[model samples]
Target: MATSRRVSRVAELIKREVSQMLLHDIKDDRVGAGMVSVTDVDVSGDLQHAKVFVSIYGTDEARAETMAGLKSATGYVRSELGQRVRLRRTPEIVFQEDRSIERGNRVISLINQLNQNRQIDDAVAIEEVDEFDDE
Candidate 1:
């Protein structure tokens, strides 16, 4: 079993190397369908598996295609990591689409919309009070 610090270090290294691969080494057309970026990497405590979180900016279909491409290229990525990283064994790579950013953006938009509606209502109330005072 690896210590927590070692596990974190490995996860960061994997994240950096995989980001480099996605940027330069990967040649899959589907991966290029969307603008993909690595959001985070989670490695198991044992260092036997790594989950690569990615945030893609595009339509739903494009996101799907990019995920499929990542899945298919797992073996290649593992091999490359094995070569570049001096680990006893390369951790298995699993690509996961991180939707947290999308969700957060949605929440922010909702809040903004609500604020606009509140301001409109307040203006209407103020106008009503002014008319009442004149009459």
Candidate 2:
């Protein structure tokens, strides 16, 4: 319970460190996408594994490249985390590309379009109803 919280904190710290490293320190060409953000981190209770959710803004190819770059650099990232976080054993980092934001935006856009269409239809229907009443 409490240990899980500690692990979660460490996971967040790792995410921050990794983000900073990617932004300023990493020199990999594959990581040269538009921007990458750490969205979520889930750490196991045993503190031996962490799942990192990352959101990338760019083309799909760029996102895939960034993911590949991160996967290749996981060992280096884990070592860096161990040095900075003072853990007995550094947890293995797993990268996952998150599309939740994209999905949410799509849903909102669909709702707005539907609402607009409904408004137009209602206006037409009301006009027809008034014409029939007059007749």
Candidate 3:
């Protein structure tokens, strides 16, 4: 089993290399159809597999297409990793779509909306109290 530190380091390296490839090396039209960014990477303890999390900004169809493109290019990405990183055995790559960022943004928006509504309700309550007090 690889140490946690080593695994994390390898994960980061893979994330960086994959991000570079997406930015410059990858030429798949489907992938280029959407704006994709590498969000995170997870490597197994044995360093035999890696999951690449990507956040794509676009419609659902575009996102799906981008994922398919990434999946199709996995072999190329893995081969590139073998050349860029000096590992005894290059890990198998798995592309996963990450929607955490979108979920987080949605949660934040809901929180803000609730806060705004609460403020408005508070103001109305204060006005009612003032009217009763004036009676």
> CA lDDT of each candidate?
0.95, 0.85, 0.98
- Compose the digit string of candidate 1's lDDT tens values, residues 1-135: 999999999999999999999999999999999999999999998899999999999999999999999999999999999999999988988999999999999999999999999999999999999999999
For residue 55, model 2's alpha carbon misses the true position, in angstroms, by: 0.5
Clashing pairs in 2: none
For all predicted structures, in order, the TM-scores are 0.96, 0.91, 0.98
The alpha-carbon deviation from the true structure for residue 119 of candidate 3, after best TM-score superposition, in angstroms, is: 0.4
Name the top lDDT candidate: 3
Clashing pairs in 3: none
lDDT of 3 by residue, 1-135 (tens): 999999999999999999999999999999998899999999999999999999999999999999999999999999999999999999999999999999999999999999999999999999999999999
Model 1 spans > 4 angstroms off: none
TM-score top scorer: 3
How many collisions per candidate? 0, 0, 0
lDDT of candidate 2 over 37-111, digit per residue (tens): 889888888888889889989999899999998888888878877887878888888989999999999999999
1 versus 3: better TM-score goes to:
3
